[model samples]
Target chain A: MSQVKTLALVTGGSRGFGVAICEQLAKKVENIDFSLYARSQQGLESTEKLIKQIKPSANVNLFVADFGDIASLQSVWSQSLKKVNFSEYQRVWLFNNHGSLGPITNVSEYVFNSFLIFIDMDQDHLSNFKEIESEITLNVTSVFVTSSLFLKEIKSVSTPIETSVINTSSLAAIQPFDTWGIYCVGKAAREMLLSVITAECKDTPNIKTLNWSPGAMGTDMNKEILVKTKDEGSKQFWEDMIKNNKLVDPNFSAGKMIDLLISNTYTSAAHIDVADA
Target chain B: MSQVKTLALVTGGSRGFGVAICEQLAKKVENIDFSLYARSQQGLESTEKLIKQIKPSANVNLFVADFGDIASLQSVWSQSLKKVNFSEYQRVWLFNNHGSLGPITNVSEYVFNSFLIFIDMDQDHLSNFKEIESEITLNVTSVFVTSSLFLKEIKSVSTPIETSVINTSSLAAIQPFDTWGIYCVGKAAREMLLSVITAECKDTPNIKTLNWSPGAMGTDMNKEILVKTKDEGSKQFWEDMIKNNKLVDPNFSAGKMIDLLISNTYTSAAHIDVADA
Candidate 1:
């Protein structure tokens, strides 16, 4: 009797909600294999260590990559996925859970008549656009391409296999948050990417796609929000959420998403938030 | 009494809908000074010629630069706007009307298992990603930054100039077009960018943003759809629309948008489609 094998890959698997996803999947899926991707080697190793502590014989591979560099993302991802013995696995999942909260500022803060000091903004504030560009690359371009490649890699596996692609989404995708313009645009674009994929992949029902809004989680991103966010209203809103201990734990949020997957209760391309489930 | 000198800038102003917008604005805006931007110098000159024919003495200046090049966009936009005597104008407008329809193919067509010949797609087809990337920059990034810079340039105008920034939007921004994933993403992102700006710019009553979905129009892009589009369903959809003459004329659609601006009937940051009016 032959048993089916399972494989999972998680982007941004080095920290926060990504780490939560890695841990939860390891505990829930029987004899699961993982390929983790992140920018930091140390964070990837540490996440691997935590996984190993749970299951000593677990197969976990770490890929370190900066999402901003297109060449690096394409090369590292292609090489790692090329090595997968896809025929041996009956189930595969790609968790596109990695992304950053791009500059938390009003869209207009990027504007101004510098010489006229139109809004008490810096004359050369457009320089701040570099970070915005890098953030866009990580959140939009890389995510779209990564998911595209995931579909590409799975198409070649002759063996009958089920594939699920999940994107970590946010409330900001649907609701406009003050000063969260770039972040909002990125989430909305990512969600639409999955929606388009679902529409295009009906001819291939074996392939699944989802946009899971993880909700407000206690992560490094939240910590950063507390310090450097420029929008006082958004900043205060987060502060109150933190002060009231209203933030969802990363593990809890991740577990809910995994349950949705396990139960197969989600419609493909649905943007189901944690609050919904 | 100092007379109010009205100024208008139209991006993608070389041809099609862009040309329509220039002609309509010059006809309607009461001796409006024109600044036109497009990648083609010849196209810009033609647009200028059309504007000059409409209003023999119209102040038409042409700036030619590729939207995909950041340095060129910055330098050209800045130098052109700097030459403007903002104080002399009581009204300013920017028509962010340029974009492209990128890769009208199913999202899965981008996928494949090369070794197994999983999908009968080209092995190196991801190279098509270059077009998608360029299209996104033209549609989303350039639009966002251009609107931002417009806000910046007008901001320094010490005079109380009533400013309007309009993004030429599409039904695709709110609806999914099968096989038009990249184009849909760009429209959605652009629309949301304006929404966030509207939300953020509440304090600056002088600045207003509008997204006008022009509906389907006879254009070079539509012509391309009949020839190169890979999705039969989408291609047929456009083909039928063309054959039936159900498509909106560029002049008519652009004229309606100009009416919205002239009437000041739209809520700032509101997405108003031609059908609605």
Candidate 2:
């Protein structure tokens, strides 16, 4: 019977589903130290307060990070790691929960009208590639870099520790959306990255991975999707969900995720939606 | 038909499947003008020779450019388009055929021992992110940029031209391969990009797109896969493939792909493999 101390590293903990995930983890994981990273200090503090109120004794450290800025991202991640003693914990959880959909716009200079192949693009088309590159760096590159770093750094610890890597995936990972083109690509790519990790670590039962898709949620993200989406049917579908109040709560979705990790019932490296779970 | 002159632009036209595809297009398409881009002038020239030997009157222009260098890519694409009068042709084909398997190694610092999660990364680990980013830029970013630019620039011609954006995809696009981590992600992402395009132009049958997977071809890529792959079972499978001479010929595969294009029966934006086609 070894003593168990868990290290829950959560990105995007400042707000939305990230905050909910932090709060859920706070209530569930006993004797846990949270390394919460996000871009906003104020938001991180608020999440910290919520976490502390739930588990007063939980030790939480916040790191302000901009995933789009790789230089700052590297500095932030390294700085966060300086204080951590990996051997002090028997369990490590890496939650790749941070992502962005960029601008909910058309694929490029094309404004996307069916049957109309050519339309005059605006001056904004000049900077389209820049936006596309930045969005990709944030959504796709950061996930790969962070997960690789986490596995590398954490595994360096001499002692054997159970590890779980949870990817905050979406139905978008498997399905394509019209205006959400880049978002869908990023999500789909991230899903495959997890699948590769799953295949590579198949024999290692302790190193469990799951792509957890939190269903359409009542979050700022959903609000953005509803507002900026270009596809009428897609927009109407989401608007209906909002009007019907049918969206999943962030906390409820986070609970399912944490429960899946705790219950250890999910097939490692498989995508399990909150609805299914 | 008043006039239908086809312009076929193939990347990776230096050798292997690119050459085969160019050859097939030269043989099949009447009054075809070929604009071929690749890193090797010799190889593109070879492909051009093959095309000219088949269709003696085929007008071929070769651009030697590196997809890895975005500056050079822009220059190359723009240069290739400089001499072209858009209205001269009724069909424009942009073949996103160039991609890299990168180093057929593990994802990152992790060597992937299944049970052993961490191993000391070499000094090469310092450059790992650089490689990852570059591979991504070449495979995923370039595909998006090129396709966007092609659709945008070519559509401005005002005259109705039948355009086909053919993405050189693979089974890797749908299945995750152990050592081919970035390749798999890039392919998968490209597949979705076409899907988004498909959805965007559902009513525009003139704007055809296909994710043409050429199958397990006997090309330089296959040789590299055989040599560098880290997984024993995967390597064994490929080795058996080589031993049994089960690899698809590049020309045969290319013929299948072009035939699918000529037959025009594949669902828009669907992945159509050579064997399946």
Candidate 1 clashing pairs? Answer: A112-B152, A156-B113
DockQ of 1: 0.51
Give the i-RMS of model 1 in Å. Answer: 2.1
TM-score of chain B of 1: 0.91
lDDT of 2 at B46: 88
Question: Which pairs, if any, clash in model 2?
Answer: none
Residue A123 lDDT, candidate 2, scale 0-100: 20
Model 2 ranges off by over 4 Å: A1-3, A108-126, A230-236, B1-3, B71-83, B108-126, B154-160
Candidate 2, DockQ score (0 to 1): 0.46
Best by DockQ: 1
Q: Fraction of reference contacts reproduced per prediction?
A: 0.45, 0.42
